[model samples]
Target: MTAPRTLLDKLWAAHEILRREDGVSLLWVDRHLVHEGSHHGFAKLAARGLKVAEPDLTFAVVDHYAPTRDRAHITDPQIARMIDTLRTNAKAQGLRIYDLTDPEQGIVHVIGPEQGLTLPGLLVNCGDSHTSTHGAFGALAFGIGATEVAHVLATQTVWQRKPRAMRITVEGTLAPGVSAKDIALGWIAALGTDGAQGHAVEYAGSAIRGLSMEGRMTLCNLSIEGGARFGMIAPDQTTFEYLENRPNAPKGAAWEQACADWAALTSDPDATFEREVKFDARDIAPTVTWGTSPEQALPITARIPDPDTVTPAKADAARAALDYMGLTAGQALEGTPIDQVFIGSCTNGRIEDLRAAAAVLKGRKARVPGLISPGSAQVKAQAEAEGLDQIFTQAGLEWAASGCSMCVGMNGDLVGEGMRCASSTNRNFRGRQGRGARTHLMSPAMVAAAAVTGALTDVRPLMNGRAA
Candidate 1:
């Protein structure tokens, strides 16, 4: 009799090439995603005179340093140089690159699934932290450092230690006005930032299964914030349907075979994990981050916690975060003034996120400056076709080209110093958007509400016609 295996164990065993005495396993990488920042890795490869081992399996994009406003010419010299370097290196290596003009060009994470480059039971790697976003397809995807990127380029394999497995299950139906982003924020708030350290997390149960593919991506995208290298959901009919008709998806008999194989990718009934946690969907509400960290989240209706009331071990850090955010203890997070609103990022920049924001801003005008950048060129085109762009622009929002704009403040779309922004990006770390900038992370609809009211406002009221 054989022992039951968890999904993570099955995937790991299938990809393992060799086990070494140092407790590391060499695993095959099915896909590699690179961005403009990959210049460092390409430089290393050039220094060693090594060409990419499997160029066909690798893809590149000009997202990180690409300008969202002006597409003709990048004004910043340093950014232009990085983009040119990526283009030259990718062309020389015979790897497919999604240039600025490419209709497929967008954030690496966004384009991967849209193009069918991400599939179940495969290993994926990228040079950005949010690469875990691909795990929504039941793939073992995670971020790698620059050195590791060079290694993958030289030999489509990476050496890694096996991580412990943890399963997070959510049951019950989500209430109206609640979203996957809120579920993620609430979960991270319940579990500290280091809760899933050295582990691979698998999300399961009714609530997860009920979410759309975009919602699943949003949930898995935040796995890194919980200290997990990988986050996954077992592929099902929802996953297969999304991949159908995609540009690179398997065709004919190969598609049938692939679906059959993916059907068996789930964990055995008796499989066990090293850690398990459960949540009821009904208990979750629209959530927002008040302090510096993503884990410093609270339901929109709740008041901020006083440092004195927190655990003794967390008191000092809480106090410091509050001070840096310029917020006082026990104050309500609602009605806090905001200077900006950003509605794009790998975490929540999909077409669905844009539609949600548009629904809120349909008959309203923004009270603050808002920026709307779609996740991919395809997404941007779809929004325009649906007239979502017109709604945003008419609501006093700035509709820009697709890229990682205002997410990291690296590509000239930065929130000014000392300004507070209600953002749809994933992280809320201190100075993540800009030096001395305060970021309040929330869902796209919530960001729209904040833009309309120029303050941290609950999205439910706007959705129900209760707010101005």
Candidate 2:
């Protein structure tokens, strides 16, 4: 009899074409997602005089450098060139692209799932670290480097060493205002960065099963921040309902069959993992990054950690982070002033995130300047239809077009140097938003709370009487 298999084991076996003497597995690429940053791979392809092996299986998007404002006239020549470069390359290869003008245009991670290009049991790859975002759909997904991108482009396959399996299970019910972002930050804080290194993580249990697809995506999107190779959640009704009728999703009868296949994609009851961790959902709260790393997070009510309280390695990192962020040891995280706020990114730029922010900012005015970029053009349109745009504008925030905006700092929408920003985007690494820009990562609602108060504030108070 065969031993029970984990979801990771099943996924790896399904896509692995062959194993080499060095123990590297050749994986068949099911979907290759490329953004403006893929120029290096395209350049390599050009220099090698090669064409994309399977253009139909590859998708290109104009993000990262896509402008969030004044699309008709991009002021930055470099940004304009980046967009054009991606467009030119996509056209040259006959690959479908979500261009700036495309209604479906958005962050590659955002649009891939929305358009149904990301499916259960498929292998997805992107040049960006957040390619793990696709794993939320129960697919095997991971980020590839520039060389791997070129390899996939030329041969429709990638060489990789199989990663170990890890399971992170969260049980119990989440408190109000506690989101998947909070759950993610809580786990990273407990385990520290690199906790899941060399492993593909599977999030399971009650709380995970209860999350919306958007929340699942947010959770998986931040997996890389904890040094996970990727993260996944088994496909269930929530997953199926979200994929139903999506443009690229299977049609009618095929959809039923696909769902059936997806239903069997979960890890078996007796499946074993290399490592396991469990958390009670009730323990998680509205959490935020107090320092430069995602693992440097704490509940909003907590104080900044003192370097002396942690291990030598963590103490060193904490000291450096505190110095860079201009915070004192044991300082209260709440009430720390913020210069600006941003609410958008592949991590939290979905419609649900927008609605969460708007719910808090509806009748309130932001004390600091901020920008709200939707995850996709469709999301922007939907927000407008729902009057969420007016709520944001009235609350003294700029409502911009969809793209990877302030999150990347590569696009024109950048946080000014030396500014402190309350951001909903994933990653608070030094210079992630801009050089010397101090970023405090939090949920969209928390960012909204900070925007309204002009400080790092807990979102629960603001959510008390609001309709979510």
Candidate 3:
């Protein structure tokens, strides 16, 4: 009798061409996502006089350096050059490129699944760290370095070292006001940042299954924050429904066959994992990060940790984070002032995330300057069609076009030095949003609540009552 195989094992076996004695294997890549930064890879290819092995399987987008506020003009000379270079490279390689003005343009991670370019039981790679976001669809997706990118572009395959498998199961139902962002923050807090190091984490159990495809993307998006290179969930009805009418999704008979194949992609019941962890969904609360690290998260109602109370190994880092954030240990996180509120990123820039923020901002004005950027042009159009943009603008928040925006400081949008921002984007590391900027990471609703209140406010109460 054969032993049960894990989803990771199955995926690895399916694409693996040869396993070397040095623990490296050549694996076929199903999708290659490229961004402006990928110009380096293209330059390498040019230097070597090489052409893309499979241009049809590669996709490009202008996200990192694209301006979210101005669609007509990109003012930064360096950024404009990078965008132009990417366009030139894509054209030369005959790869599909979503230019800045393309209706399909958006953050690479956000557009992949939305367009159905990401699918179950496939291998996806990108030049950006959040490429694991595609893994939400049950794909074996992860980020690769510039050199690796050139190799994939040249041969449509990657030399990889297989990672150990870990399963994180969340049971029970989430309480009201709690979101996928909160669940992710709570998990990072409980397990610490490096808990999943060298592992591919598969999120499972009732609570994870209950989340929508967007929510699952938010969960998997932060896999890197937990020090995991890959994260995934088994494809199910929710996954299929989301991909049904997408632009690149299978059609007619192919759709039916795809569904059948996806249905069989789940891990066997008796499959064993290298590591396993469990959490009760009911125990999680609306969470927010208090320090530079995502793992420094706590419930909105809880106080910041006193650095001295942390273990010796973590105490120094905790102190450093508090000092950098200008936060005092043991202080209440609620009511902490924020200079800005940003509600978008690959992590929480989906239409559902916009709806949640809009729900909180409706009929109320923001107490602080706020910006809202949709995940893609389609998502932006959808939000406008649904009047979500009106709701945000009515609440005194700037409705911006789709791009990475303030999530990374590369683009024109940024929080000034020493300014505090309540952000929905992942990664609260110091200077992640801007130089000398302090970021508090939360869900879209929480960011909306903070915008309305000018502080880090719990979204649960605001959900029950109109914003004041």
- Tens-place lDDT per residue, model 1, 98-171, is 99999998889999999999999899999998888899999999999999999999999999999999999999
List, residue by residue over 1-468, the lDDT tens digit for candidate 3. Answer: 888988889888889999999989999999999999998899999999999999999999999988987667777898888889999999999999998889999999999999999999899999988998988999999999999999999999999999999999999998878889988999899989998999999999999999999999999999999999999999999999999989999999999999999998889999999999999999998999999999999999999898899999999999999999999988899999999999999999999999999989999999999889899999999999999999999899999988898999678788889999999999888898889999999999999999989999999988985421
After superposing candidate 1, which stretches have Cα over 4 Å from the reference? 465-468
TM-score of each: 0.98, 0.99, 0.98
Q: What total of clashing residue pairs does each candidate reach?
A: 0, 0, 0
- Per-residue lDDT tens digits of candidate 2, residues 229-333? 799999999999999999999998999899998899999999999999999998999999989999999999999988999788888999999999999988899
Could you say which candidate leads in lDDT? 2
lDDT of 2 at 194: 92
lDDT of 2 at 407: 94
lDDT of each: 0.92, 0.94, 0.92
Error of 1 at 179 (Å): 1.1
**Model 3 residue 317 distance off true place after TM-score fit, in angstroms:** 0.8
lDDT of 1 at 357: 91
Candidate 3 TM-score over all chains jointly:
0.98
